[model samples]
Target: MNFSVGPPGLIIAAPRSGAGKTTVTLGLLRALRRQGGAVQPFKCGPDYIDPAFHEIAAGRPSFNLDSWAMGEELIATLATEASAGATISIAEGVMGLFDGAAARGRSGTGATADLAALLGWPVVLVLDVAGQTETAAAVALGCARYRDDVDIAGVILNRVASQRHFSLVAPAFDRINMRIFGAILREDRLALPERHLGLVQAGEIPAIDQRLDALADIIAAAIDLDAIGQSARPAKAAIAIREAHSDGARSRLQPPGQRIALAQDRAFSFMYPHVLRQWRHAGAEIVPFSPLADDPPDATADAVWLPGGYPELHAGALASAHSFREGLQKLARRSIPIHGECGGHMVLGRGLEDADGNRHEMTGLLGLETSFAKRRLHLGYRRARLRIACALGAKGTEVLGHEFHYASTVSTSDDPLVDCWDAAGAEVPEQGARQGSTTGTFFHVIDRIAI
Candidate 1:
């Protein structure tokens, strides 16, 4: 059976990080939703936060489309699945349009440009014209001319000082025949709060719906919604590839268990939507429990998964959760499969030292000890080959994932879980640990090798 291309979409990108891509993307999503359009939102990399905010604005779940960690078939399949029955899809780009991993990936550089070129979608460049005026056009022109495959459809002048500022920038784009879709004046209230990782997760914000409504009001008044709608194009190339390789394209990461107990809350909220979606699609059940609420994993669960999040912020409370701690121990004794990633890995350790240098007792399922007191950034894409049989896969199974955390491991005595390498194919120290039924790593798995 052949699968057709899904809805038309546009990629929201910028010249660099913090160039107002999120703001423009969120505003456009809410604006289009308010106009009665069914908008599907997606993120271009291994991000968990922006997609949450995108969900709120679009009233739909957002999926990550990582060109580096995921294969072309998986990326295209995810985009096609998520865009079904939507009027348009809006993918928020990661960093700059061309910035990506240090080395080339299975696709390209894992850049927003790669996704754009792969899907045949047009890019709406968001230019932060705060410091300069006409020079912004030069930047857009550089991005547009940077690659022959990636199409820069139009430009959005963000953080403009005033009508005068926009007037100066508008003429430059017109001279170069570049479309100026919109000009949003500088508004401090429009900015989202940020922490060490990225924007504070969307759920933490109070009255977030009101904030999105206000954003939609501003964007609908400024941006040309009609023009943007007209510029979108379906993922024709991606759909064709999927159709030609229909049999092999159906592959997805195997679910950890039949009844997976997933830890979820503000402290452990970084689980990938696509992962869970695939699990459900495969007929696996997700039983969610909140460690922040001191809730234990369901007794009927055959396996437990602890996703990464901001456990450091709530280390004190977690230390006092007797029930959650006891439940994990019981599950491990039952020989049930258990896995953790990043913050979850930290929580499974014997102890965790918060930023204040206060040590808190954890589940102690593994011998690992972690510390946020002397925080060190561990951020990169990883190629992991499991050393022992676990929920992730059989021993020696390779998986693609990423490690993004600031916690340092003070100690660990358990056997290593995976032999790891960086995106550049250089060998890194072995990562993760396994003891009996429990296994964990700072790495968050994205997809398994296709065998």
Candidate 2:
């Protein structure tokens, strides 16, 4: 058997969170696709939402490359596997180029810079030139000089007011010896809709294709597509990926069972693509059902997984889904392994309070009650050691994951699932709840502890 080399790639990053990284990434993906290029898209951290939009623009599934939660070998293997046969790959950065968790992982800090340095890819910073022109070049120069290992190859000016604004910004970069990739004039029409978590799900947008096409047209006309394509370098890991197969470097999460029942649809759509891909590669079969559609878990399945999504938004509909609730209860009674993450954990509880303070009955599999009426943000990277054996892993197993939600726990009487610690290595309270063979947690698992 022969292995193929992965595609050349680059990272699209920014100086801060709201600096048009997503806009530039989506537009670039669509623009490259429109130019008849096979583009593979990727996200830098543990983001579920942006990858959905990436898939739409790139016409392929986008995978998360979390340096903190995942080991270097896993990241390299996944990246190489996902980029096979594509002409180029584009990874959208997280908060900022250098922003990351306080603690480092197996590699460097989980920053976009770590990924760029690891993959030998160049970073194209997207600068929001709203209020300043030459000052933008200063920011780029500082980022380029801040780290020796990571390369800041070029800069893209977003929100340029006019030709005068572009003229001022372009020459500043030339003076600093920084490459100017393109200048995007201010366009309110290109902004994607947003909700609490982030942008509204791509499927929710009725004119998603039309919007993406518009973005492609704008980006194609403004940016230098050929130059951007030429700048990409083949992934350094791609050359050594074949060795990963012989070294026992593979997915840390074991298949829950031979046949798995998965909750899907808009309400439960936060499942990771790589997790499912690993399970399938390990010979596990996934059968999907919709709780919002009153569909029950497949009875033939030996395990059931309910991933995170906007369950709070559809509390009333979920409460009224008698068949779905009954099926879950039946599965639990039969001793089948069942696990829930974030929103799914909320639905597995005794009750849920919606944003309007209305209460709705849930499956009552656990003694947990959650309320969105009194929202409190819980966001961070987590390191967890299992306190009780469940679908995720056996007792004493450690896992790396993250939590990002606005729901608070009202009450819980079940045994704790994991002894958890935040990214700073500070021990937090015991998290999640477990009863019988059922387990649930707000933490979304990315990978297990590297052995």
lDDT of 2 by residue, 1-451 (tens): 1244378899999999999999999999999998888999999998999999999999999999988888766777677887877899999999989999998965656799999888888899999999997899999999999999888889889999999878877888889898888889999877999999999999999989999999988888889989899888877844355453543354368888999999999999998898898788778999999999999999888999999999988999999999999999899999999999999998999999999999999989989999989878999888899987789887888888889999988889999999999888998764888999999999999888644
* Residue runs of model 2 more than 4 Å from their true location after superposition: 1-5, 242-251
Q: What is candidate 1's lDDT per residue for 177-257, written digit by digit as tens? A: 999898898998798889999999999998999999998888888899999999999886534544434544444678889
Best of the candidates, lDDT: 1
Per-model lDDT: 0.89, 0.89
User: Each model's RMSD to truth, in Å?
Assistant: 1.5, 1.6
Can you list the residue pairs that collide in candidate 1? none
Counted clashes in each candidate structure: 0, 0
Error of 1 at 268 (Å): 0.7
Distance from true position, residue 198, model 1, in Å?
A: 0.8
Give me the overall lDDT of model 1.
0.89
Candidate 1: where are CA atoms >4 Å away? Answer: 241-251
